[model samples]
Target: MTITLHHLRYSRSTRIIWLLEELDIGYSIVEHHRDETTNRSQDDLFAIHPLGKAPAVDVDGRVMMESGAIIEYLIETHGAGKLGVAPGEAERSAYLEWMQFTEGTLAMPVLLTMLGPRFGGLDKLPLLQGFVGGEVTKLLDYVDAHLEGREFLLESGFTGADINMEYLLELINLTGMLDQRPNAKSYLERLMARDAYKRAIEIGGPLVKLPG
Candidate 1:
């Protein structure tokens, strides 16, 4: 049976679609439209995910949710010796390290800062916003420094770790914060150069809104 990805357009789900393309796997895409009136995902889509979140998948006979978890599962199952390091390889530890760092250390702060305005406008909550911004900047700088002499996040080639990092880096760029680091800028360019990423964009490009 084909894998069925229930995804929302222009969201983090793009990473999953991109990873699948990178793996050269065939999967069916199920588009879920958000309801502007209810400000929720369509009812039918809600049934598949209680939180009504996107990037969920029906892999074979099993159901899964969350962008990170889905990518991990795909890499472990489909990537194996291809897009990731093998089990006993010395780089495997570092591979997992960057993966966790991307989500836990890097993304957490960036997301908190983004939510600052919604919770309480950054101006109204200066202290909280400052803390979050400080953390985000720290993580960005860490990544930039780490990439100074490196071509990829792990191993000698692009791996699932890079895929995960790409999503976070794109978000950083969107927030106009990536230009502060030259290494980050160069890394983003290399990621954009991948043929799989290019094809993934073509497949999912309609959903991507280019910045004016």
Candidate 2:
């Protein structure tokens, strides 16, 4: 059965779209348009998942929420070991750590940094924003150094870990944080150079928007 991906434009669901393209598996996309004003997903999304979030994938008969969880499930079910590290294998801990880390650790400052201006109230305190910016730089530095001599996150080559972590890097690039970190910027370039990434972007529609 072809899986159904509920994709929200300008959202992190692009990760799942890219993963499906990389897996070269058959699936269908259900595009959900975001509110042009607020840039939020439609309330109709709640019919699929309570959170009304993007990337609520329909796997056969199951509805999966969360981009990372959907990526994990797809890789495990269809990737046939090409894109995921098994639980007991070497680098499994790192794999799992990074899989969770993208959303758990890295996303906070990345989103906070972007949303600070939108959310306002923090604009007056450049010091506070500067502090958050420092944390963002720290996170990018760690990722850049780690990716210095490697093409993929794991020694095993590209895995779901890359799929999970890459969207955050895309966000970082959008914020222009990548300019200072050549390695991280190059990492985005490398990942985007893939035919799958390009196809996914085409399939999901362009993510680029007018800068805020």
Candidate 3:
């Protein structure tokens, strides 16, 4: 099957590029850059998906959105003895939990921490920054605790869950809260050391390091 990824520069879509490389599949990447000042996805993305989001892929003829969903789809379609744990495996539940947790649980705080400072009046409020910063730090601690003594989330080697998680942790790290969590820091370092991840960077561009 043919796969074409509609990628946004310096966004979560880069995680998909990493996965595609790990899957060892042949797929084309179509890059969409954010406006330099506005830092918004180009209007062209709306033509691909109604929500106009990145990490949208054209799989054969169907258009798919959401980074988590796309990762699962690729794993189901292309991952066998690689990148994912098949159904009925004991690790499957943990794998699913982490995949969902990355976007569902972790992403919310990161979003708030980022957007809270950028919105007009809120930027002037120290209270807003303290509340959001505290929340992000707590969540980072929870994740770092989960990562202790493990190379991957599910304990079945590096699966798609790592791909889902590393992006969020990297974003959290940029806040400087990451250095406090040693396990979390090393976990990210390990993922980046992968050649697939490096190659994905070459194709999709680097992930965004600073919070907006």
Rank ordering of all candidates by TM-score, starting from the highest: 2, 3, 1
lDDT of 2 by residue, 1-212 (tens): 66998888877888888999899988888888888898877777877888889888998778988777888889899988888888889988988888888988898988888778777756678888888888898999999998898888887898877877877788768778899898888888888888888898888876656567
Give the residue spans of candidate 1 off by over 4 A. 37-40, 115-120, 206-212
lDDT of 1 by residue, 40-110 (tens): 57777778878778778998878888766788788878885777776798898888788778777887887
RMSD of each: 2.4, 1.8, 2.2
- In model 3, how large is the Cα lDDT of residue 101? 90
lDDT of 3 by residue, 1-212 (tens): 99999999989999999999999999998888888788888788888988889999999989999888999989999987788877898888888888899888889878777566567644477787677778788889998898899877777788888998888777767767789899999999999999999998898878874546
Give stretches of model 2 more than 4 Å off. none
Q: Provide TM-scores for the models.
A: 0.88, 0.93, 0.92
Candidate 1's TM-score: 0.88
Give lDDT per model, in order.
Answer: 0.78, 0.84, 0.86
Q: Is candidate 2 or candidate 3 better by lDDT?
A: 3
Clashing pairs in 3: none
CA lDDT of 43 in candidate 1? 76
Candidate 2 lDDT score at position 195: 88
Q: By TM-score, who's the top model here?
A: 2
